[model samples]
Target: MERLHKLFIYRKKLVRPYIEQLLKWMDIITYVMSALLIMTLVYEHGFLISFQEIGVINRLYHIVWVVFLVDTTLHLLLNYSDTRRKYRGLAWLLSVMLYLTLIPVVFHEPEIQGGIHTFWAFFNSRLYHVILLTLLSLLQLSNGIVRLLGRRTNPSLIFASSFLIFILIGAALLMLPRATYHGISFIDALFTATSATCVTGLVSVDVSSTFTPEGLFIIIMLIQIGGLGVMTLTSFFAMFFMGNTSLYNQLVVRDMVSSQSLSSLLSTLLYILGFTLAIEAAGMGIIFLGIHGTMDMTVREELAFSAFHSISAFCNAGFSTLPGNLGNEMVMHGHNTIYITISFLIILGGIGFPILVNLYETVTYEVKRIWHHYIKGNKRMRRKIHLYNLNTRIVLIMTAILLIVGTVVIVVLEWNNAFAGMSPTDKWVQAFFNATCPRTAGFSSVGMTTFSMQTLLLMVILMMIGGGTQSTAGGVKVNVFAVVMLNLRAILIGADKVTIFNRELSHDSIRRSNATLILYLLVVFAGIFSLSLLEPQASIMALVFECTSALSTVGSSLDLTPTLGSDSKLIIIILMFVGRVGVLTLMSSIIKQKKITKYRYPSDNIIIN
Candidate 1:
């Protein structure tokens, strides 16, 4: 027994490194196979396939399946102890599924078959192929994402690079002939892909009319991934599946989710994913019910529409299935419930995940405390109520203020102009939506071109202010805006320190806010100037609006995106990318931040503006 135990321990030690190496290679192969599989599927869908072509495709799929079967088997066998401990029965179930695939491949007897034949038939079905391919593709994608995020030294660069890779892949997928009804140009596809991946809704082509269902699916996927952020999504999967989140990964995620401590990083990510899925699912259901028996489309189409719009709104992507966008009569006529639901989704999405998490924690703690006090007469529990962090307080207060002020401003300005044709209730609803939409949701219930110049200018300011930091919404961020305001107030009051909620703001925070504002303005102005030179015939106001929209990732346009020249489109694309990633993050990724020196240089005060 002692000899056998020693041999088993030695075997485990020898196989561990081999297993790790095999897993690494498997990830690389899976990445390659995923790309190839997507290409094959796209090709098959795009072109009419002959029997020979179909046979080739089937053979390719079989090879991939065989590779997966072998890899999964080895992985299970080598890591049996760890897998059993981590995943319990799930590990065994996965192993079974992998092994079952081999049965269909080995037993090819056409004459002598009963239950086996039925099983083989089901396994060979198209639905099975799709399910298997999709699962493999997701697994491969998640693996790639996890590997990319494991970079501890330069997380920002890795994060940016991942999005760029996704953009390229999405462009390639969209450039396939079958992706669009009419084949799109590479540049146009790249633009659309970037826009979708950035969750910015600036489209070069009419999405509804140009893209096929496959194209729509790709766009939606990009939006969802982009909205949640590539790093956050990948880390979530890494924690759930691999369960090997290193301390470095935890620290990086701690920064991303704005968690107070490294210990809560995993839980914070789970909250983000769970909250997003829950909200989006609820929005989808509400939208489906609201539009049910109202639209002329079939149930499937309605469900698809609901799902698409729900995701778009929640992600703040602003991509719409309807050609006319939200201005379409199906929504604007009497679907007030749908409009309200969409607006709420936008609001929730705009509120950063951190803020939501904070709120959830706070409410949960309060509820528990209340329950304890009422049921158990625990007075100590009631007194232990936790206060929200400063970031959460500022974000919530500023967001509410902006929403209310924006709504009132828009209602007052457009009541007799844009709201002239609507009833009082509809007018208020539209006003509220228009206000909220400018804060990065970008959906429009009315024609933007029809809005007066004053209203457009107001929208530009609101867009510039943007939604919360670390949110799907883009722009300067509400936190920065609030900080700037507080700093200005301090200066005006002749105070020695800039403070908010009785907490002193740091000099670094103030400096970053100032730098962000200056850099944002510079970019916007530069874009406007360049666009003016490129599209000389376009109105200056329209050019400014376009620049602001691009820089803010607002997706709202004054009928200018499609009409712009290649140079203008490229500029807008760059702006959208920078906007979504944040000017600071992009700069940080490119410019190596110098470490602080203990010895300080002489300081001097500069002349004030």
Candidate 2:
């Protein structure tokens, strides 16, 4: 090792500048390759490329592949130690794959060529090239994005812009010839893309009839991207693959993911992604089991349906491949388990990532304790106290209260109304499902038209008071609502402090909560008022419901979605964007905030009834 190190030092002194110069050129070339690769993918996927076009595309892919092949090889041969430590396994695996692409070309003997044929078919296929190129493109693009993060830019702006970029990309992809059936207009495509990207389920067109499997796949991909904030996915990929990012970059990611410490930034991101995929995978299985052999769908169709809905539900996107959504007769009748399972998945997703992390910590601690006490024969066990954080406790309590109350109320109100023909089990399941959905899960067990005015109003309220903070859910988050209510209680009791669970809320929290509620109300009211003018034919009640649903990022509608004017759709699109990105976040990005002053002005009390 010492001898090799000395030799490396000698070689570094001999040609260090050349190696450094090569690395710089490789960076620019890799970025160009990423851009070219994406354009090629879009060209191939978006249009029906002819044989000649395919050949051209394949040649382009080969060029990109060779570029990466050379890039990876140079890094390995020159800076192997640095690459190993920083890029870690990802760089090594990519290097191996890059070399493997040459196998079919290198091994030309007839006997050996027989085995290489299979290798050629796979490693040289368009699909393989697509995957490989996509990975490399993302890596390159993400590095650029991470570099941007290291700069002193407004994170909120970047956050909003990331979603915007995806929405536009998705809109463009959906406009592709093969993505939809017959065709689609740009406005409708934008609406669907915005809806999917925002995880807001309102569709101007029927997803089942209008979109092909490719389109649906695009929608689901958008949902997943939107479910996890766009910046989050990019940051995780960049950090997880590249490793040891700038402190500023780490801080930005830590803030985005709500990591408690710098050390746990990577782990927090992993937990978020890991928990999402695991839950969706598990939910997919549960859904498949519940609707198995009953939907008349083949196993492949069932699995696809299950995976799509599982992701949509967990993302709170509420997109459904079926025409009537979860209300489809095939799955809505006896498949109560699917409804219940979806409801729980929604809850789990909307419960917030911070709470998930907290729960994970609690679970891990308990498992270790039990393992030590029982398995290791240790008698002394640490007492479990305050396992839940203040935020977790507040959210869990509020969520439980909302779910239980909403379910009971819906059952009582909708028993002989919308759910008249259903059995007791179905009623409870449907009620819970509806109650769960308005909190940001878009799935519905019954048509919106069948619901009573009172039920609709209840749903509107539930939509306003959405799920937890930093969750896939939208609307005025439950955390803010809890804080506002606590503040209200404090005022009612003539107390200055908002206290709960032996913890007094910060003044800033109270102020922000009030601001958030007021902003949400303004946005919802403005949307409803504007929609009423633009969609004069729509009933006031329907307009109100539509406005609330759109602004809350809840996918439910009063059968008025398809009939809305283009102008009204644009309004809803804006609301969905605002709701998902957050009114405060948008405002923060747009409206420059003044630095905090060292002195405070005189304060006065306002007159109130």
Best by TM-score: 2
Q: How does each model score on TM-score?
A: 0.91, 0.94
lDDT of 1: 0.85
Model 1's C-alpha root-mean-square deviation from the true structure amounts to 3.2
Which candidate comes out best when scored by lDDT?
2
Local accuracy of candidate 2 as per-residue lDDT tens digits, 1-609: 999999999987989889989987997899998988997888788788799998998888889988888888888788888777778578557667767777667765345556556767677566776797798789889988888888878999999999899999999999999999899999999999999999989999989999999889999999999998898899988887788788998898899999999999989999999999999999999999988999889999999999999999999999999988888888877888888888988999999889999999999999999999989988877768999999999999999999999999999999999999889988988899999999897777798889999999999999999999999998899999999999989999999888999999999999999999999999999998998889888899999888888889998998898998888899999999999999999999999989988999899999989
> Which ranges in model 2 have alpha carbons more than 4 Å from their true place?
1-25, 73-85, 104-110, 113-127
- Residue 317, model 1, lDDT: 90
